[model samples]
Target: MILILVDALRRDHVGTYGYHQPTTPFIDELGARGVVFEDALSQAPQTLNSTASLFTSRHFPLLLWGVEHDPIPGVADDRREQWARTPRLAAANLTVAEVLSAAGYQTVALFNNPHQHATSGFSQGFDSARLLDRDAGQAYARVDSLTTAFLDWHSGRDPERAYFAYLHLMEPHNPYRPPAEYQALFPPGSGRHLYANGPPPPGFTGSDLETMTALYDAEIRFLDDGLRRLVGELELRTDLEKTLIIITADHGDELLDHGGLGHGKTVELELLRIPMIMTGGPVGPHAGTRVEALVRNIDLAPTIVEMAGLDEPGDFQGRSLVPLIDGAEPAIEPPEISYAWIAELRSLTSAEWHCMRDLANGRLTLYHRSEDPRGTLDVAGERPEIAELCLAALDRLEAEGEEARRTAEALKTVETDGAITPENAAVLEQLKALGYVEE
Candidate 1:
């Protein structure tokens, strides 16, 4: 199984998602041969929380905020030590790698995202795991290096053994700087200064937004070319038909949408909506199929586990998508609820509407997604019934998540004291440099 996770990749920016720009031709072609989920969302808008949920098949709040005891009760909220006290994925939780590895599949991971590095407990189940250097600067580990590492690692492995390889590409992230060739793909302009120090300067004009977006698109194109090369290597080295390939993003980015330059600050659609496409290996006859039902990133791990003919872990909160891939109705319909949590902001999205709550200020806003996909129009006052229903749903979800979290905590044999090691300090420094964690 090959899982390729692109960081901060917006769904609408891709060609398959109806964007006019040809930024992702390789991904578009892959979508044509796979099943596409029309509405897929990440559990959180930030990499740390979202990627944790993706691997554990649990919500971010449950993972980070659902501990039995607060590790540092008196520390300031902005302090690094306070954030370090947040819970990591428990050792008891069965990860996708652990399940596959137990089933005799070789598990490997090459991740560029700092949050998924070894210090975060994300490397628990992988037989081999590598993280890019903290000082790699804006581009981090480029796709070329990532692909080369995967190819080299796979070359030494036994060809007959089933294997699962995960690649997290960090291109197209903030401080977007495409190659010289790709920089010329868009109209030449100097927008680098706008986002060089994080976010466009105050009093930024609409034209400035356009220029910055063009730079981001160029980065996308550059990554697209790199993906094409990687796919070529896959075809040359392995049987494409037998390998399960999954392409998706950890979360999406916001470029002046909802008045933000980046993610993790808001639960707008642009930040939560992600692209998910699956092809090969257990997809069966569902080629070129698009399922309109809502899916979450948490569902991917369980689906991959089931596809590998292993039993889904009992603690997994997500259901398998194999039934949908086989052209049959899922025994249980996809849940109407999709959730996103970032610090004090909590969002719940339904089929036609979205509701967000600010836990700090008790502010509530609702958007009719069918009429306003961009979530610019606030209709909370106009549709009080819908808002009330969504709030009730959010309450129920939080209650259930908290209950499950406590259960998991009780099952732990060893309690974590939240001590920071040298490795964790290095990881924190990298995340702060990348603008994911605030210093």
Candidate 2:
């Protein structure tokens, strides 16, 4: 099985997802031959937390609030302190990679996201985990190079083996420097205030949004071309049909939809919704069909396990998605999609009402999707009872989340004095450039 995570890919940017551009033609083509999940959501709005939830099959509260890089206040003394220990796995959350590895599948992960650093506990089940690093701040090429190398390594292995490959690409991420050729092919310039190259254009608007989106689309096309080549190569291989393949994103990017340059702090549609599609192997039907039923990243592990015909762990909160893939209306009750912005918790009902509850203080915001799809208009004051219902759900989720955090923390073994050393500084600097941290 191959799970390819396209970093920072927004759901609406692809042709299959109603994007007018032909930027993601390859992925769009794949969707035609596979089950395309239309309403897949990320557990958290950020990469590290979302990845943790996906791998462990747990929600935000069940996993640690922050990974080794994005540390919450007082959680650890320093960055090094966070990295020095073997992290805890959420109770009853077993990585899909672990399950596959134990079932005679060789699992390898080729990741470029710094959040996937070994210290983050995301490397738990893989037989080989490699990180993409760079010189002179250019790293996307490193990801492509490493991915190609990893594929070559696996391809050279025994042909009879069934393996799971996780390719993590950080294109369309920030440092929005798509190659010169590609930059010319799309709308010009990174839209938001420039963090690196220079000052951003003034009076950004929907047109600028389209322009920046064009550049991002260019990057997506870059990835698409590469992935198409990879797929073509695999088609020539002996076990193409036997190998399962899944392509999705860790999370989406918000191009200033809610006054944010890059992702990490928003639950807006542009940030939380991502693409999830499966091709090849044991993935069931609904081929070429879109399933709009709400699903979250936490469900990935359970889904993979169920696809493999293994019993899901009892305590996992995420339900398997096999039924949806099999072209049936989802048999499982849809869970409310929840997200967090620092200490504030937010949730959305499958029916369309979205709610936010501030944990640091008592405040509630509610929006009815039918009326305010962009989340521009707040209807909390207009509907007190509905707001209360959403707030109550958020409160319950947060309470449960707090307990999960405590449990995961309890599993940790303290190791360092919590100081950020030179090595830690290097990593943090990369994260900062990636908009994962502020200087």
lDDT of 2 by residue, 365-414 (tens): 77786788667877889999888777666667777776555444433222
Q: How does model 1 fare in lDDT?
A: 0.78
TM-score for candidate 1, please give it.
0.86
Clashing pairs in 1: none
- What residue runs in model 2 are displaced by over 4 Å at the alpha carbon? 61-93, 135-137, 141-143, 189-211, 330-343, 349-351, 414-439
- TM values, all candidates: 0.86, 0.82
Once model 1 is optimally superposed onto the true structure by TM-score, how far is the C-alpha of residue 433 displaced, in angstroms? Answer: 41
Tens digit per residue, CA lDDT, model 1, 266-351: 88889899999988777635789998877889989899998988888776877787776775874344455688887778899877
Ten-residue segment with the worst summed lDDT in candidate 1? 67-76
